[model samples]
Target: MKQTVEPVLQDKFERRFLYLRLSITDVCNFKCNYCLPDGYRPNGTKNSSFLQLDEIQRVVSAFAHCGTNKVRITGGEPSLRKDFTEIIASVAQTQGIEKVATTTNGYRMAEHVAQWRDAGLTHINVSVDSLDANQFNAITGQDRFKQVMSGIDRAFEVGFKQVKVNTVLMKDLNDYSLPQFLDWIKHRPIQLRFIELMQTGEMDDLFARHHVSGVSIRNRLIAQGWLLKSRQANDGPAQVYYHPDYLGEIGLIMPYEKGFCTSCNRLRVSAMGKLHLCLFGEGGLDLRHLLTNDDDQPALIEFIQQQLETKKVSHFLDQGNSGATPHLASIGG
Candidate 1:
């Protein structure tokens, strides 16, 4: 990929867009309540729906040209992609790109952990809601807790230094399991994040039943003697903190409690090639046609820049709506 020092992608809010969350496939292996509560069916087989390797590389190049240094490869479950390691290598090697990461459920990761680490995968964020086998099954609608834990261990063993655990702390569901989560991270250099539940799908009742506030989590951590302080790094929407007692720090992502709209700097590209400015946005600019039908790089940059002007100040989901325009399953969380 040829490198060009394009101007940094800045939105009207003066938020510099240096991070890109690129979804390679929307289809997943497990169904979580926060996402596809009912199970998922791929719109097309691997032969047709998923973005081709070349297509993915071009998107990375384009975003890198627009000053996106960090790229997080997300999916319904990213490891489900057959050439996942290759995708990591491609993005990690792109000119001007600094870091490449993946967010996965960890079911299919054990087999390829070493390969991915060797292929330049910078970080891994595993979505684990519970440590109990039964609760895990109930949450994900899958019997893969052992597999997931094994994959997480493998990632750490393979020397992926920044392996973090993303635990969605629900109220009645997994709220009682915070101790279990803390015990699991003991003496391990794995940071844990309690992601507050957000209204993103057709499940208002679910949120009412299981949504846990970040304040509750903070109090729990303080009771455990964790010295928590607000972090300033705008790496993402995570409200980070530090605890000297633990090997790794703790974080709280309050998408509903604390909105990060003023400093929202990330843009999303769905697997089908649509550029989304907000996670809860309804529509996006189609870049597939530009990639396949045209060869004008400047035109592609201009198109994305123009669309960035229309980004919503904050997500519509935050407003007490039943759901957002695009369901969670369609985009990578």
Candidate 2:
């Protein structure tokens, strides 16, 4: 039975979504101060398992049918899943999905990155908060900075033209070390991304104490002769900049900035199979039931389109509302 194809996913604000950030697990090994500080805790429930392979495949296929060209496999740490490579392959082989990316802590990258690339992983983003080893340890509660760095080198060796590094800029922390970050990326093909600290439901105190805007960073880049690059149709929200002297690039993700959501082009799906219209929006629509079989693809597509219509034009982050999001790890930040 041929299912009727729906129009591309778009919201009332006239923004078209061409990317999906799909979380494969809520379990993260790192205890980042802003996110899972104490470590990942299971609720000890029988139904706490993440979506299975088949479920992810069916849901991704439905999304592909609705015009999602890129699928970024995210997680508390997506690489933690044993079947992560399989997940990448499935998403890459899905019709209409041109890109298969993943975000990780780089714990296993040094060991398994080649296998990941061979399994159809198109792009990789690693979290590297600080250039100083000790500061990196303090921020992420891990002393594997050397290993993570090695993983990045391996990524390049394995033929990744450019790797992205996500650094959450926070006051009195790595915020002052932008110069060091710049020097490190000057000769490498790394896209050093600086993400603004966001306030979540569980970290009000942390947010108040460490939140730093990306405006200053953007200004600094412009003053330093970094040219703002135009965004592609399937690109994420990061405002990318390139310079003539550097082999690398820089990206700024300022969620609190005015008109930030005006160019939003991605949607999130939790590891437990809930579709989130916005990263900081309210509750998600449960789609796990609809992801069970291939026969459910049509209904799943319909439900997604219907729910997408209710998406808010912008998030309430400016109003201090990180609705239903306890922290970044829960839904794959």
Candidate 3:
């Protein structure tokens, strides 16, 4: 008998990806300016491209089989799906999938957090551009402040170990809201993160106009005598810090920060099931057909491994070159 060979999610550079971003749907309820604009529809056949329950199980289990232990369920808003609870539970139950996480706008999370937590959802990242109601609405193009806040509070109340708040800093837009953000996190258990907006899609112009460096924000935190903490083991990429007197920690994810690309361990799967090795690279391996069919699972596994060799040296955004922005709702950034 021939000895079996184990499969892995490794790139040419020898970095292994234990995490997988699984975007289940291209639908969303909120229209954040920096993300999904007021009127952006992700291109795809809603019925065909969007993974059905069985397809989701097959694809997730395949990746999990190849050493992907973590999965983050994302979307224009993952909560938009009628089968949100079922999806989470199913992904969580996949063999070899040790962790299941989700990123959302918190619009529908609060009321359903208990169900999510019960379904083995281990982590959550909520995008909160601003704490002020008016600014929040201005950024998201929706008046859903209370619902989001309620959801955040409910996550904590339900015993989530990690509840992060993501803030995308813009130059003239919500920069002034940082002080209030700090004040809010000073007493809450929720960790706050400052994300440097990446120039994707319609966000290129917005980034050029409103982008601010996360390094500057971290510097401000240090200036206030906050101490830098050693990196903790986690699937997501964010440099973390702490303040001795505060209840929450602070994190920064600057996509263009120096030395950011040398260690890459992420592979993105679009809502339509195309595998993108790099966030800004062109062309992708379409997994939709492979997913819909049942016979070539082993072949599909080998195809993914082969494609890993084609991972780019780095993202185009690092060179200050912005390409066509994929609608984030569709891509699940």
Candidate 4:
């Protein structure tokens, strides 16, 4: 069942590069305050609307055929998918997929890290907003900090080489823990990423509450001797910085604070197989139809290419009022 391979040309004219963010499912175990707002209801349709395992494989195959070398599985929490291991194994086996990774909340990574690693998961990024148990509980709406931390420890113990801790800096909330979190990661192998809050979902209001820019955080860290240098040839949005004396690196993803849209080279596939050309896009291509109807590989490839041709050079968040784009959780951010 080897899928056909094709050459893909990135929008930036970069050759032999494709990074796909595949969302396996929209279901998540944790109700993070930033991801989900109060009084929010699960869009119940997602459970039934998720792409089948075979459909996911076909899509990955098509992407790989089109020269996709890297695939990162995400979800409401990717580990929640029952067939997650199989999915990872299938993607890892794809011809052009050089790397297979996932981003999870770390609730189940402890129990599943070894299994995922065996299934060919190369790296993982675990979301841990706060180090303190009480603060963690408040941020994630769960009292599972112990479980999450345990999962992180197990991931590193199980030989996951590039384990990163993604922390969203929410002002007056998790912002206070910035120095403490960076200090905590100094001795660990895990890289730390401080993400600036984006306007998505119910987070639009919280944007003003937690909108700590990456510049402020970096300047603060630099004042404390954290040397911020760039990493060459890294994929995705994060601007990575390394501390020469420290064991691991720190990344600052300032998508909102600093627009990196000119060099954006990645696309997103929602759990349902919608090809999102831009993170803030209002619409997506229905890739499920191409995968399910006669498995039209050529047509699918053309469709993606055409979409990319129309891909806006950059998004204009300033054009519309605050409520323009949908929430990030729904789009698998």
TM-score of each model, in listed order: 0.92, 0.97, 0.94, 0.92
lDDT of 1 by residue, 1-333 (tens): 999565567877777898899998888878898777888766555636667788888888888987888899998787777888899999999998888888998887788889988999888899898888999999999999999889988888888776788988888899898877777667788888888887755767787788888888888788878875654433877766666656776878877665557768788888888888888777667888767632656677888888878776777555776334445657676
> Judged by lDDT against the true structure, how good is candidate 1?
0.80
Model 1: weakest 10-residue lDDT segment is: 321-330
Give RMSD to native, each candidate: 3.0, 1.9, 1.8, 3.3
What RMSD does model 3 have?
1.8
Give candidate 2 regions above 4 Å deviation.
1-6, 44-48
Candidates sorted by TM-score, best first: 2, 3, 1, 4
Give a tens-digit lDDT track for model 3, residues 281-308.
7756788777766676787788899999
- Error in Å for residue 161 of model 4: 2.2
Ordering by lDDT: 2, 3, 1, 4
> Which has the better lDDT: candidate 1, or candidate 2?
2
Instruction: Estimate the TM-score for candidate 1.
Output: 0.92
Q: Report lDDT (CA) for all predictions.
A: 0.80, 0.90, 0.82, 0.78
Tell me how far the alpha carbon of residue 290 in candidate 2 is from the true structure, in angstroms, after superposition: 0.7
Model 3 weakest lDDT span, ten residues long: 39-48
